[model samples]
Target: MSEIVTTRQQTPGDLQRLDEAPTPAEYLGRMLSDRPALRIGTRTSPMAMAQAGTVQRLLDERAGVASEIVGISTSGDQWMGDLSKLGGKGAFLKQIERALVMGHVDIAVHAMKDVPGDVPLAEGTALAAYLPREDVHDVLVVREGSKYRSLDEMPPGTRIGTSAVRRKAQLLKHRPDLHVDRLRGNVNSRIAKLDAEAQFEAIVLNASGLRRTGLEHRATEVLSTDIMCPPVGSGVVGVQCRTADTAIAEALRLLDDPMTRTLITAERTMLHGLQGHCNSPIAGHATMTGDGQLSLKGMVFTREGGKFAYAQEWDAPDRAAELGAYVAAVLLRKGARGIIDGIPH
Candidate 1:
């Protein structure tokens, strides 16, 4: 992968300033002078294509630039087994990032939740901007003719299909008698399986994915955050690009939602601090209050759902990382470390 290119000329004073210092508008203005047509790399899934289309529309409206979509097949797209065994969520991003690094594409559009907390990126490539977030909650999709309105309403030993360890743990924690089975595939595939296969009574899925794919009508119940804490970065779509490609970066910046960025940064920071991967039974959700303060809630559970830790913290929006770390520290002190360590990579 190509390394990130830094276009800024660093001076002694610039080196002394904090890294968080804002870039001068003059610099951004100069970069915006040329709106280069961009090629965005994305997975071939319908939902992924829809997300890329969203980015394409935003670029047309905000940056007045034309763009083409490039469909890239990722390891996660082909893998039929467990995601963790294939290297967690990073599997979904590797080929897309490769396309950016190789100059085949100018930007990579992805679901933020599919991004691993600490995966290394090409030196010059970074997440440039986050689109406005969608509903950050999980939903239950029951088979047709099922009378269940919620997980609690299901009968004991009801087979629930979901691939996420966090969802598995949370479901078992609340209903020990429910049967949790691994359900793999894209959003449409999972729903099809739930409807056509008699083995599964219901399945759990992210609300954002369903909404993005126009399948929200299939959701039988939208689980509250209190009932099921969302994964870090859920509901947010992000654009990644070479840092040195200031034109693309500035163009994508037009789509950045400040509050969403702050909240996702905090949640991802907490996940990073805990060294949690996609398969780890870890959950976090961050939200901004009307007054601009941020609150973060995090949870960690054992593989068997026998032990768990939970913590929450609040801080200024600018201190999102600090707040995430604080809550992570609290959870670790409460034995979250043991829970995380016991999970297989």
Candidate 2:
């Protein structure tokens, strides 16, 4: 089993200053030239590569910097069995993060949803920036020959596939008569199963992921958050670097989206407060209202979807963490802890 770790380091003062350069672009270009092309560590998945490309593009646009993608075969991607057996979602990031610690990569690009909220970041690493968010909705993708076009259209005992415990609980809660089974593999393989005469009438997936894979056309319907509350940290790509890498941090800061940061912060804070495991069916979503207030909703469910707790709250955007904590406390008061503890990992 790979462990999630990175080197703890301290930044040494550079004698150079921004004012020393003729312009901001020139300054950044000079700074970038001080080292080899920036190395971005990522998984080998199409989605992961797409995210890494996005970072590279942003760097070129914002700081006149070039980058190289360092694809890593993470233990999570290599493991074909259940992720829970490997101690949950952390399996996906441990090796890639370790690469950063070993100086093989300067930055790590992660689909924020794949990151585990229950644990702090690997030692010596920090989440420096969040790319602007994409649509966070989960969508239904029906098999080509299936009779069902929507969850409501499906008759009793209709089969749906998804490996996420979050989706399973939510689906059962919404339509208990429909059979929800675990579907494994990446988006391409999962869809191949559906098109390869598998038993699933439909499979649920994230809209942004579909878009990233250029498979959005395969989606049958976009589900509302009310029906399928997104998991925490959905629809965002996070940039992570060594904690002491001041130059890297400064460069990544240029790509940060403050609004996305606030939304993800609130959602992730609530998730961490729940102390959820991989099998814990927890869902959360946060949004900025028209008037600039932050609204957060959180949920917890039992494995069978027979028991659950939910809470929503509002606060100022700057109080994102406070709002998340408040919603988490409310849900706990509503028995979210018992529901969370009752599930098997």
Candidate 3:
């Protein structure tokens, strides 16, 4: 490991700042006896680093902890050139989680959607907490000067692009006349494919992706949940650390937003119970109301949207998991299982 390097010299304003900044020694003292540097393992992608950096900054401000990002190239980033071909979810998180289990990182930060339902953390490792969510909607980006305002408005046979089976199925179900195609890459790369190659008439992308990459301006239309329910845990940030590392968990506690976590918990449970992943044609969304209740909306659809199965909203914090399970059961009862099993797998 290299010595910790500060990019900028300490200035009067930085020194006087009362937001709680810790020296390297201070942070290291709490971590291990040798006080090795705090290594935050993360994917090298721009968006991944941005998310990790945000938490690192907050750790300093809120907990007086200092750390550095240890960029690790994962399989997901390596094969960004072709994602759809790589089956299943957890594509982006497996390597990072492995690094954590191998003691390369003290803590791991992740976009909740990318994390697998089955994470085998080392004996003492555990998920610390999840941060608040961002907007959970998919956006449509068409070439400039396009008169189409919605998917229904687009001409039949229009080429639609997406990397997720969930989105492809949902959109096709709504507009059977349109054609869906595979799109894979970072936000910038996807945009290039659309603009340069004109390979797709429009692309369905997570609204949060656009915000994270500062490309929201390209969004021609934001599809609501009514049109396209987002993937489970789409916009939440999750933090994981060794379960024995009480100090790190306590330090990260302040970052947890309980209400957001509660709602996302239901969404994730729904996904898990349904055995769904990035490649599955599954979509669900959850929201918490001021009346101290949780509401969840979920759906299962075919790739071409020829048929769909949906479940009603369930409101009950204590039964959040049950609510999700109930929805899946409902979908199963509605012939969703047959449709799901029919996929080419």
| Candidate with maximal lDDT | 2
**Residues 141-166, model 1: lDDT tens digits:** 99887888788789998999998888
Candidates ranked by TM-score, best first? 2, 1, 3
Task: Please give, for residues 1-345, the per-residue lDDT of candidate 2 as tens digits.
Answer: 999899865444333543354566557677777789999999998888999999999998887888999999888888878899987889889988899988989999999998998878889999999999999999999998876778999999999999899999999999989899898888888999998977898999999999999999999889999989998989999999998887788889889999999999899999888898999999999998899899999999887687899898999999999999999999999999888888777
Relative to the unseen true structure, what is the Cα RMSD of model 2? 10.6
For model 2 the local lDDT of residue 328 reads 92
RMSD of each: 10.1, 10.6, 10.1
The models' CA-based lDDT, in order, is 0.87, 0.90, 0.77
Q: Tell me the tens digit of each residue's lDDT in model 3 across 1-345.
A: 989976988888877884467554445335544455568888786777888888888777766677889998878877855443564456677778788888889899888877665443446777677877888899999865567757778898999888888888878777878889888877777887888887788888888878887889999888989888887788888888877777777777767888777887788777776765344577778887789778888888877777888887767887788887777778788887787777765
CA error at residue 145 for candidate 1, angstroms: 2.6
Runs of candidate 3 with Cα error greater than 4 angstroms are: 1-37, 80-87, 118-123, 144-149
Distance (Å) between predicted and true CA of 183, model 1? 0.2
Candidate 1 segments whose C-alpha is farther than 4 A from its true place: 1-36
Models 1 onward score TM values of 0.89, 0.92, 0.85
